[model samples]
Target: MAHRPDTLEHAPLGRDSAYPEQYDAGLLYPIPRAANRAPLGIDDDKLPFVGEDEWHAFEVSWLNGRGKPIVAVARFRLPANSPNLIESKSWKLYLNSLNQTRFASREDVQRTLLRDLAAAAGGSVSVELLGVDDSELVPQRLPGECLDDLDIDVSDYTPSAAHLAVGEVIVEETLYSHLLKSNCPVTGQPDWGSVLIRYKGPKIDREGLLRYLIGYRQHQDFHEHCVEHIFTDLMQLAKPEELLVLARYVRRGGLDISPWRATPGLTPPSPLRLARQ
Candidate 1:
């Protein structure tokens, strides 16, 4: 189905919802990416960057072949060009449906999730189930300089490109800040996160960049869209030759969303959880 801004009103967000007693793929809501991309001058067929929406479900559980409870964490990688983005709350509900359902094995659960999520996202999605002790799931800090120590005054809390400025010095560096905060457009609840920005081109004014990130404190949007907005804004304002923007948001409803968009050939950084996640 095509996405419209108003379609979110029908999704299982903002309103109280019932938990499903059985596995129901229909509970997953797909919001087409075009609806939000249109405002940013992005075409679904001609995306500027390649990346993925890495989702970690921390409260995943299901019954085994013998009806014994099993618990594991799940990581889902959704392509950036996917036709649709699954609404977070609906994703949580869909996972909850599996709590009482029985699976033959972890492989079976992973296969089922891959099939359902790929279909919902309208693109190939990778699903991996990890045991609680998986070493790869360890928390790590975002690699780069932290900008939160900047003693700068700020008043604007709205998203704006005006705060972004670039210097003539060509450089490649990674910078990050933990001050990223935005609101959910549907529920008005806050979404807090850390953001990493890596680029190669004219030097981006650090103070201006920090101000630009802090500007999202009062803005409202989804995680994926916010990252895309930042990517596009920097591409236009700073004219970076190469750029990557990733945000690791704190988990809500037992799930965390980390979306990254990068230059066509640049590899995405590891999807490690931050301390706050």
Candidate 2:
């Protein structure tokens, strides 16, 4: 039953809107990250993890100098420590604005994206425009054992840190589940995704972990916030020496968002899409 921050009051989500006729940097909307983090007991100046939000835009199209249409995909990386998180609907609308705009070259489009996104994020944002045939666009499965087949009783659908527990056995492992689903805070639309956990510490109770993840079924939040919540919950319950929590969400409006949070010194996982993405 968490509510979106007051900063999102005027965001483009949940309301009807028309596509922009031309490029408009002003279309991008940003919500302060601290607003959501405050409730989680996370301080903006002392974040517990390091990571980024990987975003892919699959329906990008623009005009070349010759007035011919150019189609390509885009990848964006926004640092987790950024001051703000861009609103997804506004991001879609901002990208849609480029549909009829003309750019001299792909680099030109990328530069514009980088500048605008970085400004909105309040941090440096990585923007890459790739051809549709780029290999990075190929889908792959998430690493580790899938927890979807476990037969466990569950009734609650709200997230609770108490559902997470760990055993005495110490081990290093990776586990994942595709049943992670949460609703959008603004529009209440379902956001389906797969979540992966990697840690080196006491053996976590798989059933409890799965139940904890499933508890978000009726939760409301953004993909980045959800991953952070999972990460924080695990850290509090297991006290792992190392931990990483990642969520790869399905595409909505031609875009997919994957957010990962990890203890310092752990390398990030490959930014690859799952088959369902």
Candidate 3:
């Protein structure tokens, strides 16, 4: 979906706010997903794929009942059908509020987060708080074939599905690229990420897919929107019988957002933190 020029004006992004040191759920901002989905011809009832957004908060902290500081990592998984998404800047501000607040226990903190975030998202959001020492917090690489070594001329910056091609042969494969880059809708700041494409259908032309992915270099949109665009493009162009599109973006403001879309019957992949994240 193309960037909505007016949405940024209503959001707290590219602006300042009174950061609360106390736990205040009002600090969270929710942007309606329909605003962006409408442009892509994607409505709530006509979703093309099923998936979830896995978000990692690396700098989570709070004061204990005894006035001792405690730190942990947070993972939030929001379903793709959620009516809204929490703004990154607002989420960061909300998390910072917990820093000076005192909680009786980690369970209390988790309950608060689950309630506040789910209210903001307009849906049920799964929350997980892991200790800093938890081995599950280990960083892992995406499993796929890297396609960054292609030597091709890339001059076009606008997205074009014409760049996608499917050969006469049929095969199942997974392809990925670490060169995915896009600009933030509000700040125009660069967002670097990697993309993974897996499907069971006609073999996609590697060069064409790479070019299509790179065409977003100058595009300005949220990480989730870009993944939806890629999914819709491939479904229309390549017509893959079974398809999955996942984007892993680097952290910005101590938070990273990863979105994945797949066919109805297929389960989504587990979350992983790449070295860049």
lDDT for each candidate structure? 0.92, 0.91, 0.87
Model 1 lDDT tens row, 1-277: 3333437878989989999999998888999889899999999999999889999998899999999999999999999999999999999999999999999988899899988898889889999889889988889988989999999999999989999988889999999999999999899999999999999999999999999999999998999999999999999988888999999999999999999999887865785788888
Q: RMSD, each candidate, Å? A: 1.7, 3.1, 3.2
Which candidate order results from sorting by lDDT in descending order? Answer: 1, 2, 3
Task: Give, for candidate 1, the lowest lDDT window spanning 10 residues.
Answer: 1-10
Candidate 3 segments whose C-alpha is farther than 4 A from its true place: 1-6
Local accuracy of candidate 3 as per-residue lDDT tens digits, 142-240 = 777888898988888879988888888989888999999999988999999999998989899898889999999999999999999999889988788
TM-score of each: 0.97, 0.97, 0.95
Better of 2 and 3 by TM-score: 2
TM-score, model 1 to reference = 0.97
Candidate 2, position 37, lDDT: 90
Worst 10 residues of 2 by lDDT: 1-10
Task: Tell me the tens digit of each residue's lDDT in model 2 across 43-71.
Answer: 98999999999999998999998899999
Q: Which stretches of candidate 1 lie over 4 Å from their true place?
A: 1-6
